[model samples]
Target: MERLTLSVTIDRPIGYDHHGTIYPINYGYVAGVIGGDGEAQDVYVLTEDDKPLESFTGELIAVVHRGDDVETKWVVTDFDVSYTADEIMATVRFMEQYFKSTIEMVD
Candidate 1:
């Protein structure tokens, strides 16, 4: 799969409260990359560390396409590991459940 090195700035950390929806994982964005929403590209960093993080440098493994929204979230991992689409979905469901999303593994 195609992988890109990205330096993500974690804006929303684990347990972050957003309108009563607690974040279960690290949610960040690539510093200079603008996404479909015209902002920093949002990313979901999948890592072994469960605690909150300030920033992460990792590989972009997949892209989450939201049919209902213009923003597409990317999945990144710091460890030398790969995650199936199902696994990625399950990990991000905490927030993705609100959108019609599909994961495209990088190739």
Candidate 2:
């Protein structure tokens, strides 16, 4: 089945801190045509330091068949103290690719 992949650039780090430890947060917004069929699915995956925290998989965040039109937004606190837009985008891209690859492997 063919999958649709979309990419976006983020300029800020999305993370949060608890107690005295800081966590690196990562997230992805995915929407695509399902196997060229008329059905579509939107999904969101949020993580803390490469671990899955929460996810909306196999369905759209808002609607099931409206996956292709789904949108995702994420916020992270306490990223690196010196991160820049370029660095954040690079990190987001890496996480997005990793998530996509992992999902494909599991399918």
Task: Report the number of the highest-lDDT candidate.
Answer: 1
Q: Mind giving the per-residue lDDT tens digits that candidate 1 earns over 1-107?
A: 47888899999999999999999999999988899999999999999989999999999999999999999999999757889999999999998999999999996
**Deviating ranges (above 4 Å) for candidate 1:** none
lDDT by residue (31-71, candidate 2, tens digit) is 34342234332233322345434432221111112233333
Query: RMSD in Å for candidate 2, one decimal?
Result: 13.7
Strongest candidate by TM-score: 1
* Structure candidate 1, residue pairs in collision: none
